[model samples]
Target: MTTIKDVAKKAGVSVATVSRFLNDSGYVSLEAAKAVTSAVEELKYESNPVARSLNTKKSNLVGLILPDITNPFFPELARAVEDVGLTYGYTVVLCNSDEDPEKEKNYIETLKKKYIAGFIVTSNQLDAPHYANAKVPIVALDRTINEKIPIVSSNNAGAIMGTNALLERGCRNILFLRGPEKLNPANDRYEGFLEAIRNSDAHYQVVTCPFHFADSQKIVENVLKDHPQIDGIFASSDVSAAGALKAAGIVGKHVPDELQIVGFDGVAMGEMLSPGLTTVAQDVYKMGAIAARVLIKRIENKEIEQNFYEVPVKLVIRGTTREGME
Candidate 1:
């Protein structure tokens, strides 16, 4: 039960030092090596051959393929996954697809050749047939790719809650900034937003974006040019919401007054915005941890019944929207 991290802590040495002592993979000072050996003996630490064998037959690495590293959300998710993988003595290889399908496919092929233990993919494309025949386990993060692969994501209820928040703030006219239709989470958010406003008196419109700030900014600017009556906006992601904010500012519309906005993805940078973006925050860390745990279990050939896991979300109220705007 005692891990190398535990040995490292007790020995007052780094985990890398302990790992080197354990595997003789690299050079270590005699004092550090002695400390690690003493600590391992004291703790009765046992190496997990079974766990090592899971990835060792090919490689002791887990591949984490993401759409964009520039997106803060994905990086945070990747960090959590890497942390989990390291705790289990596996190296995490990060591959950014940059939202390119061909690039994603190429990375998949490359990592496959490397014999990665498993994959935690945040796919940009809707259909990824390359992973269909992946010999190792695969888990989708934040979106559904292959139907056979399990997916771990945040709850789509944030959209409904966000829409209601805007409506509660006296926003009668709202705009929903949706993301790519191929993403399951994006579609869920769009559907949830529509469902919330269906029976309400709030007038709403939908604008799809590529989930990029520039594109979303342009879309909002054009939408505002034509429909100045738009008082509220609910964006599918924080970056898009930032674009909406920029457009509102360009038109001299004050947040929480003339125009209120709510964005999905409770990214850390949201708090840095001028008014601190109001958002529906997903537990990115939790999503990553759950995905890593599930994928590792699958890699170990453990029996798992549930294939879909949805982490809960919260409505993070900030200065962007009013509880009941006057």
Candidate 2:
């Protein structure tokens, strides 16, 4: 295989100059850059990434650590991150921690040894000290770690709009299928729901559930069975909404007629569900893209305008909710 030394010889430049030009590190004269480019093209030279990483103490690899891959929301976010990383000539390495802090720590440690360029994390370990001291660029996605870390997320307070839509439809008794209490987004959403119902005449109850369909389905089924008067539901996630829909079907409550439902996270699975899910639609793709971009910029030592990026969200009316009744 052709080597940097050979390229230097062909370009009439020292190996150090060629290395500087290739890495875009130290400044190189225009003439030297032109000669190196020509020589690289002519020789079809491909630098060894492993060696380059070792030499520079960094790799062109970005790590995306997600809490749960089974959730459709995360897969969509992963795709966005991967696409943006490719455009910036970086490869994305996906890690599924299953919301396990230990597993997440292991991944972070392993990647750090490899000199990963940066990370985009969606973790539930908000108080984990690993992130604060990782000594690497990291952008939190869909979750908040700490104020010091940069974050890219949706407007979690958008849940208020969804709750209001239910009230507008004359839902007197609403059930909120809340997510894990430890998650910042879940707390924000619950707070939004509470704010929307604070002065409303509607009766409401909150139940915590994991962001899992089966678990949510079981809890919702029991709640709906015991509280037959519950006519509306605001689920913390599309997965939970699907579970609520399933539970409603089992409990013989016809959606949008006897019951109305609104889900968060405008995941594609929501659109595929029968009757579809009325939901608070967050631009998840944009969140992932922005998080990746921010992490990449930080890794490259570029200035970022802000530390927090909150993408806007809107409530999407669908078959799950009564329309034209508000």
Candidate 3:
């Protein structure tokens, strides 16, 4: 559909002028108003003020740049964002940054050139040097490099929620697994797990994984060989958690009986497992919804000068946790 933006560009007048003319406001000059009217007529413009605002500065569109859209976590979050966006009469543009800094930089530059209203960035690493010159408002999801940009993240207080969930369930010597350490989320969760163990007067071992299935499996296999006393395990992510589950099965260990396991992200795979995986649900869907609302409010609302959107975390007790334990 030919929008008011087309009319403004064709008439060579500012979008505000076209909007004023369309509204029959008295301020627009007679000549400019006539040109806008003629252009609107010729182009069959729909006179949508929202589309006209595209030319002015607000396009009623919010772009979401996620690190891994393929991940179950991201897809659910994306759906939540799109759901909330449509309700507010705004459009969403989805982009995958692939966790590459250069790819992320390119996406920001591309969206800016396309005149997107704002962005909700979900990168793996927290490095956004490109934002120092960003023209539009930006909200970070999971990654926050610059203090100037608003961050909407899960409450990364600690893995105590996940770790303690496993420990209290008779998991004496547990294996705590991890992924890449570039971002603060992983580090924070790891630290929380350690604190939980210390506080509980329990003994556990930490195993570092490379944020992938195969690598984590290798780490688990090595840990199993070195330590046969491990009674429980806490994997950093659902992907790696799945790998841990499979690896334990390889050694003929029954979940929550011979051993207990817990995962993160509350991913779709968690429930499908034999013993549904207990996980620390970060409320990914809510995170995306909150991020969209905050960035849009900060940009559209003239009243609010500053804001912070913080998402809370919760431990989802599923079939994965010990049947009778904590």
Candidate 4:
């Protein structure tokens, strides 16, 4: 295999100059750059990534840590991150923590040992101190880790919008299908829901469930069975909204007439549901893309204008809600 020294000899440049040019670490004269490029092309030279990482203390790999892969929303987010990473000449390594703090910690330590360049994290272990001291650039996606860490997320007020939609449709008794209590996004959404109904006369109940479909379905089924007065449901996620919809059907509740539902995250599966799902549509792809870009920029020592990036969200009306209520 051709080596950097051979490239330097072929281009009439010192090995140090060639290294500087290849890594873009230091300035090289235009003539030297041109010669190095020509030599590299002629020799078909491919630098060893492992050696380069050892020398630079960083790799061409970005780590994306997600809380749960079973949620459909995360897959879409992962795709966006992967696409952006590839475009920027970086490979994305996906790590699913399954909402386990120990697993997430292990992934972080292992990736850091391998000199991973940066991280895009959507896991629930943001409160861990190691993340604050990870010494690696981290961009929180769809979750708030802390003020010190940069975050890219949609407006949490989307939940308020969803809640108001249910209230406006004459839903006096509403049930909120919330996610885990400790998760930041889940708390932000639950807070948004409370803010929306603060002065309203709606009687609402909050129930916690995992983002999984089966668990949400089972919980929602029980809630619907015990409280026949629940005329509307505002789920923290589209998967939960789907569960509520299924539960309503199993309990013989006619949707949009007897019960109305609103879900967050405008995932594609929402549209496949029988009446379709009305949702607070967040641009999951854009959030992921922005997180990746922010991480890459930090890795490249570029200036970022802001630490907190808030993407906008909108309420999408669909078959789940009553017509003429928008």
Model 2 ranges with Cα > 4 A deviation: none
Candidate 1 per-residue lDDT over residues 1-326, each given as its tens digit: 89878999999999888866776667999999889889989999987765545434556688888877888888888889989988887788989887787887888788777677899988856666777776679998877766778999889867899999998888999999989887788999998998999969889999888778888988999999899899999999999999999998887888878999999999998999999999999999999998998888888778777999989999999989876544
lDDT of 2 at 240: 93
Who wins the lDDT comparison?
Answer: 2
Model 2, span 96-155: residue lDDT tens: 998898999999999999999988899888788888889999999866777878989799
Worst 10 residues of 1 by lDDT: 49-58
lDDT of candidates 1 onward, in order: 0.86, 0.92, 0.78, 0.91
> Order the candidates by TM-score, highest first — what do you get?
2, 4, 3, 1
lDDT per residue (tens digit) for residues 211-284 in model 4: 77888899999999999999999999998999899999999999999999999989999999999999999999
For model 3, where is the 10-residue window of minimal lDDT? 301-310
> Model 3, range 1-326, lDDT digits (tens) per residue?
87667888999998778877775444998789789878988998776565456545557778888877787788988998899888887789988888888887888888776677888887766555676567788888776658777887777664788988887798888898866778678887888888888887667888778667777777787787678888888988888888888888787777768778888777787888877888887888898888877777766744444545657778888765666755
Q: What's model 2's overall lDDT?
A: 0.92
RMSD (Å) per prediction: 8.3, 1.6, 5.0, 1.9
lDDT, residue 259, model 1: 93
TM-score of each: 0.81, 0.95, 0.83, 0.93
Q: What value does the lDDT take at residue 316 in candidate 3?
A: 83
Please state the error at residue 152 of candidate 2 in Å: 0.4
Find the candidate with the highest TM-score and give its number.
Answer: 2
